[model samples]
Target: MAEDNFEAAPGGFIPGPISSGRGGSGSTARTANSNTLLSEQDVALAAPQADAVPPVIQTLRLQAEATTGVTRGSVSGGTTTTTPVVVSLANASTSDRPNADAADGDAYVDFGGLNGNFNAGSGEYLQWSFAVPAAGTYDLAFGYAFFSASATNRPMRLEVNGKIWDRLFDFTNTGANTTYSEAVTRVYLEAGTQTVRLTATGFSGPNLDYLEIRSADPHRIVIQAEDLLPAATNTTATTVNREITLPFLNGKTPAETFRVGAEGDAYLDWGSEANTLDIPVTATVAGTYSVTITYANGGTTGRPLTLTYLDGTAIGTFALAPTTAPTAYPAFYGDLVPAVRPADGSDAGDVPDQSGWEGWTKSTLTVNVTLNAGTTVLRLSGAGGAQHRQVRVRAGGGVQARAGRPIRHHARQSHGGREPVRRRDRPCHRHRRRFRCAHHRGLRGCEPQHPLRGR
Candidate 1:
């Protein structure tokens, strides 16, 4: 689920937004087929609030109904407009623009008084051009339709500023000729004249109702603890042969006996040569980022973990300060139950508090590194016993490192991006899932909370 809630074009919410491509109208009677577009309720529910802090404003929103400085063929009539109209605009060519009618009914009923027509084998498309005031990040929201007998599974390609951003579907045919499905996602943009196009990719292309583009909020990139793939271990087995040293092992508590984050109740291998953890990482954009690593040291002194890039570039080895070090078997309280999936199941919201999360004391260490834009693994070799938490990269303002609470575990994927600035200043978690940036699915802790009431 994306942070931005998708609004149905005119009717109420349509489950999953896809009509069976199998074309089975005979199987069941379609209900409410007359409402082709989203209802007023959906539009109101989907509206993003203006940030009370900074008052976020839309860079551009093009509605097909009225004159908004858009190129139109001005052609009238005909149920389907297959002819391509070439209307030159600021930064795009209307050479492939779709045929349109000013009449309002059926497919055109709620789509701002008019709608662009697309169908199978129609090379035609619809586009709107805008002058980008500045370069940063923006969220592209499309209100569209194509859910009908022929529109099911219609494939459409979204091209922004001449680059194919994605290929999407008009989805399940609603069997209703007038319905439109809406979707919202984030994209990176360089400041300039930008053209956004919804061109036909295959049969029964979708209709374009409206499009909204707004500057994205500042955000961070996080590497979840559990998602890290082990690069190398000190032993094919156990380090320093803790199995053999019965006397030393039996007398002292081992960090492995404790369950932390994802490593529940399993023994953490520790010895001069037994302890080493490595995780693969990649940076999409080259920039200086503040790196923070969280860990729990059961011992009285700080545990030293040497850090280095895959290429052997020393990222500066540092000691994890002693915090919650376990003293005995089952040292920490509470079991490491499965991570709780958030209410939205996207995990793109406030970090949920764990029931028995506080096991051992946890602490953090910080370092700054300007990484090259590509894939590389960071290795951590501890000279003593310690538990590893997740790592994160923060840009612009700083978010305090969470010590005792659980953190969101995002997948191991690198996206080249600069942090997004929030449009409004509201409590983070309140609007936690409100708006997401390019990091939509994979936000800070997967996603940090923020208010986005930009209307």
Candidate 2:
């Protein structure tokens, strides 16, 4: 009956033999029977091998019936019954918790709600890590949009790998709804995973955006405006007056001419020929004129030409030479000279002293006469009549002399008897003798008076 009951309990029963004996034999048979029973029990309690492990059994229990929907059920024995929830696997991290609906043998991580906000005067920043296929150049792109209307007042800058990589955008002046997208190519990336970060330095509002990176061709040329004229380092030159002849690169040609001054009273004129041209400039006031010239090959050159008034006389014929082309002609001519007459006590020329003086052509006489600190007189008169010629005399270095009036001095004594006689007791008077009697008396044959006057 026990065997039948044990076999009927859904598991197979163990077989046992009935034994009869006395004393030592009975004890031995009893020990053997006990061992058999223990062995059977041990066989039933032993854990199954991995290959013979039974499939997990799941039992569903209906907890409550919904009034207008399907009945809710609870599952046990390593099975789960819950609503399916999708989670992002790309951004999963080890510190995250698994979702409630995660099943056995399935990997999962918990991700909170996506919440991002940037405040005024605060910049938007992003960080990410990725793996690279190989060592080569990569293209990086960043796309951004304003979150709120207040974000329009902020300025934005993009930084990659702690280096600025795009043009800055001022949100205040660049409009509210403006979208910013930038792309930088030829960024060298290694053959492993790298962490890229985008930092907004100057943004001052709710300005946040997304960043994208990729690979692209590494070979390309970039041209900048400053690179066009690298050889044209000096943009200024000092020149006398407003005239300047700029020596350019051998094959360079002029395109346009421009002049800037304090007032619009300045102008610039270029030569008609192609190469080796002259620029004639004019300005009303003395100042630095910014001159810019555009070349024929779409390049430009700039220089400064100082314009000033002609102050001194410059004499001599200056000729312009022709180079590869005809020589450029001058636009204007000027001369600086005095326009006045002589001053007081100046020299005057007198009448002709010889026959050749009648037809003699008067050559300009420039006499630099220095006087002592005191007053002095210089007489000058034309060799002919007073009305025949005019005289001009100047004082100082470059100042012209004004017209002067002539004055005459009358003599109180005649040319004859100019010397007076001297006496021993009369205080040595100045003598005025009309003639010497020694030579004239002998010519007239007058007898000489003897030493003794009494005879």
Candidate 3:
């Protein structure tokens, strides 16, 4: 019931849902595929300048206990302390937690780890102070655990610079109580040290581990479903129930279990057409973009929806096919198979996943649209019943990257000294390549929607 208390700052931004099986630890690294949708002339005209400077992406990781102060609150009686790390991390000393000799050689601040096995009760909080070289919006990731006996959610309120950012924010289960996962959100910060506080909204909250902050990618705009503006009466922001089992790792007796939903256990249930959403997007670079919606449908057929500009100009229409499975664990989670460590112990690049569904199979639908520089609004009207987690708007032009590897946008072969452009959802005469969407047939700068990594 705590989710009913959803709140966001005035004209504010939130985060995606619980991100266990969804992807990496809310990292900015994304998976993209080559798109040959534009002609050679269009490609040459829209390509990035060779001398253009890359945007500086800022990142920081701070241990929870490493904060300037750890205070004990008297509201509900709770305490905080440092405990051994419970989850595997890329930078961790060891991958094994249960069998590890000593806490993975790292310790995390634990809320209520001393006074009780639960989190700090309502009114108790943990605060972190850090300095930023740039003034901009940054994504915040809280590494935590909430494997309660009740299997219920633990809600907390995120405060940035003494102002509430997200009220009643929560996370999905971490598979096991000792295991950990990251819940992400967004906050705009001015240059210099800023204080962030997480206060329990429920009787208690998830255990504290560490907090990671990174400058939001300028080219990729991620809009959380919960952050939709002009909140509709029928729309509800909440989480769903789903079970995830990780791949069978070598030397591990029982494999790890991954939970479903976006990073912060947040999503929007589009109740019906009345629950239409007005989404705000800030594009640093003016151009065409591919808007990918991460969603799930439990029905047997596709869920129809329409995307358009504020003035009612059609951007695209999608009938996302059903992603539900009859089984307890859907094969859709199998998309994460490539992320499993190989037998040779070499890194598999930690590919992010495409599993955002809760119980049902997770899926994505993308539409291409053009925009000018600055902020804009897009309207989304749906037949309803779809669980939308997040929307990612990516720059449309240029040679796209996939799994962090660069690939050619156009085929090697050419015709009449011009690279043949391939239209999405339609087979090309020369290349015979087709993509996913078909609604953007007449739209300029339209391109095929590339699938996410590990899918």
**Tens-digit per-residue lDDT, 98-134, candidate 2:** 3211212122211111133232222233344555666
List the candidates' TM-scores in order: 0.31, 0.21, 0.45
Best by lDDT: 3
Q: State which candidate has the highest TM-score.
A: 3
CA-lDDT, candidates in order: 0.38, 0.22, 0.47
Better of 1 and 2 by TM-score: 1
What lDDT score goes with residue 404 in model 3? 32
Model 1 regions more than 4 Å off? 1-56, 65-68, 72-81, 84-119, 167-179, 217-455
Compute the lDDT for candidate 2.
0.22
The local distance difference test score of model 3 is 0.47
Ranking by TM-score: 3, 1, 2
lDDT of 1 at 191: 66
